[model samples]
Each structure stands twice: as structure tokens, then as C-alpha cells.
Target: AYDGGSPTRSSQMRLDIVILDINDHAPVFNQSRYQALISESLLPGASVLQVYATDADQGPNGDVRYEINRRQSDPEGYFTINAQSGLIQINKPLDYETRKVHELVVQAKDGAEQPEVGTAFVSIQVRDSNDNQPSMTIIFLSEDGAPRVSEGANPGQYVARISVSDP
Candidate 1:
């Protein structure tokens, strides 16, 4: 550079710049916790619910995949998740008598080499259905081996013992 009235001089230089995409953002779930109620008779492979997550990064760093966190939830392998859609499905039969409620920890991870993950708590309440048949047992209270009631039996008189259970 030179003053306007004196002399002119110039210098030339080459400059190089590069922009890189980095995994700087972790996946974030739309909700911290989700709740759902489903009938115990719901068949396997049926959709339970869908979880959502997003990342602020670009490209692969923002592509999120879903999974059931086995270490934290679903030890019995009762549920499965779609990596692309975050749709959760029943992997096994649900029985309200066996398990009334199920708590799961769902995780979403970015496509980065060292993915940043986010976790969401999912509580599923299994509603009891009439899946089980009612069972009954009868015991005779008379001296004979058969259940019998006398015509003169008064109210609340013990005639036979009956037990019924539905589970």
C-alpha cells in the first residue's frame, strides 16, 4: 500500500479456508416423558407410540436413530423401536395380570462417529382385558359327597362352598 500522491505498491497473497461439519449438538426429545395406555390384548407388532427427537447440527450429525435402551429399560425384550421413524411396537404379548405397567427408557442417537444421545422416559399402562376366562370351584358342604340344599334351608344357610377367580 502507498499514499495517494506518493507511490503505489501492492502485495499479493493466497488464502485458503475450509468449513467442516462437527457433531456439536446432542439429540433432544420433544418430550422428557411420555405416557400411553394400551389394552393388554393388543397383539404383537402393534404400534404403541412414537417418540420424537431432533438435533441442531447438519447432515449426518443431525440424523437421529431410535432404540430401546436395554441397559435402562425393557430387559424382557417386550418392545422394539424403529430407527428412522421412532415408532415403538410390541415385541411380545402384554398381560395385565403379569405386568400392569411397563417403564422404558428410549434413546436417540445422532449419526456421528461418537454419537450424542438423548433419553426419554416412557410409561405404558396396560389395561386389563377379558382375556382370561373365569374359573369356578364348587365344594359340597352336606354330609353326602354332592351339593344339596334342603327346602327348609333358611337364608344365609351354608349349602355349598363356591370359589371363583378371574385372572
Candidate 2:
């Protein structure tokens, strides 16, 4: 060996790196818009439907929570949603005569410090129920002013003019 100039040995090694995930993805609903048809007789606290969403990120960033957007027009407070389960339920009585259709905006947000949010539109159509009793108006056609059938009344004869209606 001629001092430091003689030779210099070299060593080579391989290195690997791992990249962790961040809260970069927002929750996405299975459907952007949903529709349901329910009867007006549906009672309070009854389950209406379920909404679902998913996040692509890992850990807490991927966790999704559900909510009914209060910013939307829900003046009747007719519906509620489960924060963790995304189950939509009826919060009040439904009346087809009062309002036949309801529109709601639901939100899904990720569990992040600065959460990302996704929105879905829900349309509920209330089917008419037999909630109202039929009203009747009768006008007697008999010779007597009172509501009575005469003994000599002919068969299939019109006894009274009846009108019925329901709202």
C-alpha cells in the first residue's frame, strides 16, 4: 500500500422509505341524491331510510359522521339522522294534505381537525293516507220534508241526493 493514494474501498447499501397517509380525502356518499316514498301515517321516531358515505384516508381521517344540514329549510323539524349510523328517521308526524313532499340536505364529514364535508340530497314523497273522514251532504227528495221513505216509494227510486268528499 502506497499511503492514502494506493486505494479507497467503497461500500454500497440499499435504503427504503415509507409514506404515511394524511387527511386529504373527503367523504363521498354512495348516492348524491336519494328518493323515498312513505305513507303519511308514518309515526314519529320511525326509521325512514339510511344514508351511507365513505372516506379513502386511513384512521380517524377515514371515519365518517352524518348530520342533517340545519342550514337547509327544515322548519318543521320532521326528520333526524344518526351521527354515526347515518340512519334517517321521522321526527314528527307526516301529513300529505299539509305537505306532500319534503326535501332535505344531508352532510357527511370526516373526523379530522379540518374536516372535509360531502352533501347529499334526500327527497321524501308522502303518500296520501285515509286520515280524514268523509263528509256527506244529503238532500231528501221525498214528498215529506223529513228524511223518511214513503211506504209507496218505488223500487230503485232516488230517496236523497248524497254528496261526499274527503280532503
Candidate 3:
């Protein structure tokens, strides 16, 4: 036991680590609030409208999945969404008298282990279709004033008839 004891030294080392961003995220629908006008009397297989979105991620991770979350808004599933194309179509005709614009929320998330989510809003404007006929409402004119004539009328017509079109 005549040998001297050895001393130990303490030092610190640096390490380099990098985290690559993945495009595993699904495409997020910017239009969370979407409004589409579907004709109640539309022919089957008619194209209603198309939806759009973008993803922050790239590659397969960026590949998005689309679905209509109208579980609450449309209990019977009146709409359809294209997963790969992001197109929204009408599965069934929509009655403007019953419902004019549909309100829905679309969600987008990354495919990463810890995913990220984003959202957007949309407003769909439905145009009227000449499906429903307009009911005539005759009004007796008083001596106060004459019927308001249209400046761009067809020679003899008084004014444009008030006929609410359908969608």
C-alpha cells in the first residue's frame, strides 16, 4: 500500500442536435365557417361548390384528410367532402326555405407524434334557382300614388315582379 492515489479530472463537452420539421401535418381548411347554396330541386350528381385548404407540413405528412363535420349541423349527412381534392359536394338537395346557409367547422392537424392544429372560416353564398313558382300578392292602389315603374322595363311592364328564387 505504498502507491499514491490517482486524481480524477472533470470536464464538459458540447453536443450538436438538430430537429427536422416534418410535413406530416394534414391540410388545414382555412374556411372554418363555410356557406354553400344548394338547390333543393337540384338534379342528382350536380356539383355544388369546391373547398380549399393548405398544410404547413410537407410530403405525406402534409397530405390532408377531408371530411364534413356536420354531425351536428346535418344529422343526416347532407354534404360530402373529397379527402384528396378538398371538394365539398351536396349529397342531397338543400331547401332555402328550410336552411339557406350551412355553418360548419373544419379542422386540420399534423401527422406527427405531437400534432399541430389550425382552422379557418368560409362564407358560402347560394344563388336562387327558378324551381319554386312565386305566389301573386295583389295590392289595391290608393289615389295617393301610382305603381313605381322600372327605368329599365320592357316597354309596357310596370316593374320587376317580386319572385324569390330557390337555390
RMSD of each: 3.1, 4.9, 10.9
lDDT of 1 by residue, 99-161 (tens): 999999999999999999999999999999998899999998889858688899999998888
Candidate of highest TM-score: 1
The sequence of per-residue lDDT tens digits that candidate 3 reaches over residues 1-167 is: 22343565555668899777665555666555566655567754666666677777765556556655564445666666676666766677766666666665555555556656565443444555666766665442334445655466568553433444333
Candidate 1 clash figure, as a count: 0
Candidate 2 yields a Cα-based lDDT of: 0.91
Residue 110: error of model 3 in Å?
3.7
Native-referenced Cα lDDT, model 1: 0.93
Instruction: Point out the worst 10-residue segment of candidate 1 by lDDT.
Output: 1-10
Local lDDT at 145 for model 2? 54
Candidate whose lDDT is highest: 1
Per-residue lDDT tens digits for candidate 2, residues 98-159, read 99999999999999999999999999999998989999999898677569987898899888
TM-score order, best first, reads 1, 2, 3
Q: How displaced is residue 122 in candidate 3, in Å?
A: 3.9
Ranking by lDDT: 1, 2, 3
Q: Candidate 3: where is the Cα deviation over 4 Å?
A: 1-38, 113-115, 133-167
